[model samples]
Target chain A: MFMAGNVINIFKKELRTYFTTPIAYIVIAIFLVLTGWFFFSTFFLFGQTELRSFFTLLPIIFSFVIPAVTMRLFSEEFNIGSYEILVTLPVSLNEIVLGKFLAGTVFVAMMLVPTLSYAICVGFLGQLDWGPVVGGYLGALLLGAAFTAVGLFASSLTKNQIIAFIIGMIVCFTLTMVDKVLFFLPESMLGFFQFLGADYHFQNTAKGILDSRDIIYFLSATFIALYMASLRIQEKQ
Target chain B: MIEISDLTRYYGDLRALDHISLSIKRGEILGLLGPNGAGKTTLLRILTGYLAPTSGAVTAMGFSIDEKPLEIKKFIGYLPEEAPLYKDMLVYDYLNYVAAVRGITRERKTRRIRELTDICGLSEIMHRSIHELSKGYKQRVGLAHAMMSDPEILILDEPTSGLDPNQIVEIRDIIKVIGKEKTVILSTHILSEVEATCDRVVIINKGRIVADGSTAELKQSSELEYALNITLKGAEGQDVKTLLSPVEGIKEVRELGATNGELAFRLVCDTAKDIRDEVYGKIKQRDWILLEFTQEYKSLEKIFRELTKES
Candidate 1:
């Protein structure tokens, strides 16, 4: 069907808008700076040569940076009254949402590219195990996909970009922080709360244990959030 | 061809369009005339498949809007009143994107874009960002985008709302040129625009069609008469009124004033009658000096007011 064409067209336009603006550069700059700090504090000061510290801090970094890259995906269109034009096109709602999601995912992928330098530096410094490094990259991709989906859902809920950013940050932070907070909860409720946390699955995948359940969990969250974004768009119309 | 029957839309408790029904013939330029909040935008949105009607059905080119929305959307190009556009994109890029989404291939996209740019008088601003354009140019860009796919039916909601006088004339001319090949339905409060560009007029009020006919037929149906102002030197008010009252189709008469011993009287006559000859003969026989006489035709404004003022 021609839905593929619509998705590709929308993806190209959205991606171009993101890169031409200053938001993409700002996001990538901040991500690199934070990762550089983590690298220096762990490797140069503590005299460690492993990437475990770097992979450990990625979910926290992505919680903020992913939303920064995706907060304007739909909210800016609504603010400028361009959503009406987008929805009236012959394309279905699924194609539009998927196109925007893919654009946000590509932006996240670009942000992750510079961090490869950190991985390379760590690899050369020590006799590294490439298997766990590969698993860390996969985990980062899954986490970024999940965060971008949540950010897009938040973007669809409001026309104010600041509010969208704040909401996305809050949602992503909750998903990431719930695991540690569950330690203080009742024993019976810890399992339920840990099931809602992204860090649990991300930690498992970071150690080169590619659990099929963790993959399914991340994918299901991405699908449900994007589905909600499409529904929100319909409500807006 | 477009056919709508019992089409109605409600936003919660308020009825935006109330049982509206109409049909548009092929190659017709129909004007939807109404005041503010007259449901013009709602009706246009429903017809363009942007919004679903709460009740009833609309069939465009024999495709039902509810059952075959994608098919209906393929044939229609809609420009909302706000002219929704991406301000950050250049005109060429944005239109090419629209063309692609509308299924225009890359092989013919450039030629179609150039043709639309020239048709809408947007060739000069094709390379500029949309944010840098003025309101008139932005409206033209919206029109050009709508014309990108060469749709069979074009729905424009107040396409010439914010332009100056000269720009309005230019845009109206372009629309006139476009209407030769495609069906257009434009909504506006400017009645003269309806008279100038529309082959048929659909006057709406309170979500209902008050009157639907040609411009001349609507003017005739409003019972609007022509007024003749006459100034004579030797005639009194009673004499002029009695002479004009006895004429065949004079409806009423009123005296304006007497200036410098000359009498001025206004005669209201059915527009169907040409009483200038009768008045000339009567004044000639009376030996009155015929100083000034002018006939004023009924404008579309009066017809609009008369049609919308009723329930």
Candidate 2:
């Protein structure tokens, strides 16, 4: 219980840094612009009151933007040498990692908040499905958290923010594209590879199916990335 | 109390600390003195549980560093070299966050911060961003941060390395006052820093302890060795050296310089006996007029040089 409070303390501090710096605004603006352009440009073509197209493009957009949001988390601390001060404090490494992870997830949720206006606008134009809309938002959160964890792991690998951002993008991009590259794989590996693709599991939730397997996949991905990040930090220590 | 036994640490193949053993008493101001790259920082990091030792173990306040690092950290406040704080946060916010993490209850947090603010002289710049503050102010903020939990043990690595003289004095004063109650261990290569603030000094060289004692005790190790300078008028360099060289306890007498009718001779004496009177007696018996007579006490500076001097 006390450990949870320690995580919250770190979380608040990390979140404060996001709001104080220009990184949060720049990343949020780019996310809104890219998602708005991709979602609206085709909204009229389909002439549907559903947000299927917006949700489809979210995993790809987050692949780029979420890395940008999470890139500074550990890279900046290591670059500026504040990690020494942080680790010496009375908090454990697990608390610090979890706190930073939550901060990134919260920022992603804030970026998604403004897009709710699109759902309301589509509802007014025609009959809209609230079930998938809710599911898409939920899936976007889980996907954002998993990608944020990946970005955090990348940030832990180096002291350079640009390198962290690029590494995070590559890992997230690969996870997004893994299912699309199934033709090269043998038939027996198709099931395994498909299950590994983050997009496949994300789409399951985005379709309002809410399968236990999909939720488990994102949670475990986050856990594995965070665990690896902790191991890397321990190695550095 | 803190006890470290046979502590050794290595970075790859490079040994940073070698077979170190130390026991620090409660409420003692101990100074870890060494030249650069002598493993002072490495030892402090291990004690604070920031780094694991390659061998041996440390126990502080009944908590082992390996098993209860969090508990050890709970009562020890550390300020790393240069106090690499978050540059974007305000001083107040950073201190508040530290206080919360230290588990200071919310009700007592404000009062504790106010106390440190007064102690560290940070009342005026509490709201300023950390990066915008000057280096001295940043160090003071770091001091305030370290004292947030009112810890029983305080570890600071080169706390005055980059500060101005006035700031150094101010920080030393703060450390001295805190030393009255807390077990303060600070590391520095500066000899006078140990002289001014530390009750005990440990000199390390090349990853091993060369000397350890109180400031006066370290000076006393070489107390038998001292030098005396004699400046005389109407005297020749060779005559003055030959005359003073025969005095008992005088090891060597060398002519410093001769300008006009004045001559100076330095006598290197290696005995505890006061040979100044004997030298003066010899000078009075001569026709030479004595101009100056002074003895140079063995300072910690000289002892430090001798101990840490490379072979």
Candidate 3:
């Protein structure tokens, strides 16, 4: 119980840090503007009442945005030497990593909250399927959390924020685009490659499939990335 | 109480701390005196559970560092060199965050922060962001952060490294006050700081323990030699040297200089014997008017240099 409380303390501090600076507002504004423009540009062209394109565009957009959100989690601490003070406190490394990862995931959720109006707007135009809409939001959360973990892992690799952002972007972008490059692979490796793509599982839930395998893949990805980030942080000591 | 036994640490092939052992008593203000890169910070880091030693062990408050780091950390407060803090946070918010992490309950948290704010003299700038504060104020905030939990042991690395004279005095006063109740271990290259604040001094040089004792003990343990300076109005330099040279316990009597027909002589005396009375009795036999007479012992500064000087 005390362990969980320490995690909450770190989480609260990290979230407070995010809002105290203008980074949160600027990133949120840029994310909303970009997602809104791209989603509406093709909303009428597809002539579909469902918000399928918005879900389709999510993994691509998040490949850029999530990295921006999580880039400062460890990079800034390392750069400023606050990591020494932080680790020396009574809290364990697991608490620090989990807390920061949750903060990044929650920030992604907040960024997604504004885009909910896209779902409501399309619902007003015609009969919209609530099943896919709910599944899409849930899948968006899992994918956001997974990408946030990957971004945090990348951020842990260096003290330079820009380098962290770029590394995170590259990793997230590769996961999003991994399935798209399957044609270059041999026939036997096709299924294995597609299984590794983040978008494939996300698209399954976005279509309201609710497959346990898809959900497990996202959760395991988050766990693995966070585990790697914790390992990297431990190496620093 | 803390005990470190044969603790060794190396960065790649570079050894930062050789095998060093120390035992610190409760409520002792111990000073770690060393030149830069002498492993003072590395030793403190290992004691605070921040860095693992390459060999040996540290046990603090009955808990071994390797088996129970968090337990050891709970009882120790540490301020790293330069007091690196999150520059963007407000002083109040930063302290509050530390209090929470240290597991201070919400009811006691406010009262605790209020006490630290008063203790560190941070009342005026509590609401201001940390980046706006000067270096001294930032160090005070770091002090407040370290003391948030009111731990049994406080370790500070060069707590007054770059402060102005007044700020240095103020910080020394605060450390003195805190030293009364806690086991305080502070490291510095400044000799006067150790003389002013420390009860016991440990001089480290090149990762090895060179000297460890109370400041006075350290001065006494080194070769005991002191100089007595005397100035005379009517006596010639040669006459004074010859007269005082025969006195017991006076090793040498050399004329320092002559000005305005007044003469000065320096008497090197062995501390094993009291030569002041004999010299004064011998001077009473002369017609020379005594101008000035003073005794100077070997200072801690000189002893420190001698101990830490490169061979």
Candidate 4:
């Protein structure tokens, strides 16, 4: 069915579109500047060399950043009516969803790769923990993938990109806050509810623990969200 | 090549397409004529597999739309009403993207793109961004996008809409050329477009098809009447319309007279009744000299207006 070819075509087009606009560059530049400033400020102040603080700040930063990256995945096409053109093409819904998901995740990775110099700088100053650095990046990449899936689903719900971004933020924030917010739930239900939180698994991976359970959680979350997004597209057709 | 049976579509609670059925052979350029909200787009969306009918069946190239949308989509090309395009992409890149999605191999993609640029007259502005192009060129690019796969069926919704007269003619010429090798179904409210390009027409109003035939057949079969143009000699000073306005079956009389002692009058006659003989008798009785009397041809416009206005 040429499914792989369809995904590649869609990915190429999506990636090309990202580079064609100034927004991608602006987003990437802001990401590097902020991450660099925050990392160096903490490093110089504490007189220590570690990326732990930077890793801790990343989840909070990406709560807004990842949604911005993925907000237009489906929303812009729907707004401009180009989704009509896409659906009319011979490609299946799975191909479109997967292609767009990867495109957004790749853009986030492109932004993340430049920040590796921050790790190098830490290594130059003092003894650095390579384990946590690798683990933090893996966690960041996994979280970016999950956030992209959530953002893709939110974008499908509306043609307005701003609304899509807001929806993505709300959904992702809820997933992160689920573990922290135990006020309404009974004490007995806290552990089970904490397990459902997106941040709960990422904490272990961000600490370089490399837990299979955490990896499985991110993969399954991404799969489920993308599956939901595909369902929306199918119902539209 | 296509068969639609008892097709009905509902948009929420409102029925947008109501029990429509038709068959189309390969290589026929069919025109869909309808007013706004007449379900022309809806019907086309169904045919292209962009939409699903509420309760009916459509089979194109032996594949049902509901059962095998991707297979049928592989055979058909559809251009939506606005010709929605990525305005930022260069025209060449956009077409290439479409070609890639259509699974056109690299070797053939290059040759196919060259062929399309030539066919669509897009060579001059191939490197320009889509936003920089004029509306006419945008439509040409959209046409190329639809044709990139060399599809067997093309469903264009308002293919010639929102263009100047010259651009309309250009697009019409393109459609005429493409019609030779492909089965084209274009929808428009402009009867002249249908007259100029379509081999067959289906006029739909309120989601129901009212007329289906070739241009000449629809014009001839339509109950729309024609006008009788009269030129009178030696009756320049007289009010010819006043004299002939009272004739039966003549709904309205319009006069076009010159100061050189010649009068010309046109009469809108009822198709159900013959009024020419009565008008001649009245002219003779009134001693109004008649030089020429002729009936105009029944135009497609007349047929469309009459058919749409009737039910």
Judging by TM-score against the true structure, name the best candidate. 3
Query: What pairs collide in candidate 4?
Result: none
**Candidate 1 Cα deviation (angstroms), residue B45:** 1.3
Write one digit per residue (lDDT tens) for candidate 1, span A119-201. 78877887778777888889889989999999999999999999999999999988999998886899999888898899888
Write the residue-wise lDDT of candidate 4 on B145-231 in tens digits: 998898999999998888889889888998888899899999999988998999999999888989999987887687766789988
Question: What lDDT would candidate 4 get against the real structure?
Answer: 0.88
lDDT of 4 by residue, A91-180 (tens): 888899999998999998999999998889779889998998899899999998999999999999899999999999988888887888
Instruction: Please write out the lDDT profile of model 2 over residues B108-195, one tens digit for every residue.
Output: 9999999999988999999999999998888899989888898999999999988999889989999999999999999998888999
User: What is the TM-score of each predicted model, taking all chains together?
Assistant: 0.94, 0.95, 0.97, 0.91
Candidate 2: docking tier: high
What are the DockQ scores of the candidates, in order?
A: 0.68, 0.85, 0.86, 0.79
Q: Please rank every candidate by lDDT, starting with the best.
A: 3, 2, 4, 1
Candidates arranged by TM-score, highest first:
3, 2, 1, 4
Task: Mark the regions of model 4 whose C-alpha exceeds 4 Å error after superposition.
Answer: B235-259, B265-294
Q: Retained native contacts per candidate, as fractions?
A: 0.64, 0.88, 0.88, 0.90
lDDT of 1 by residue, B113-203 (tens): 8888877888889889999999999999998878778889999999999998998999899888879999999999998899999999999
Model 3 misplacement above 4 A: B259-262
| Worst lDDT 10-window in candidate 4 chain B | B234-243
- The global Cα lDDT (0 to 1) of model 1 is 0.87
What i-RMS does each candidate reach, in Å? 1.4, 0.7, 0.8, 0.9
RMSD to truth, every model: 2.1, 1.9, 1.4, 3.5
Backbone N/Cα/C clashes per model = 0, 0, 0, 0
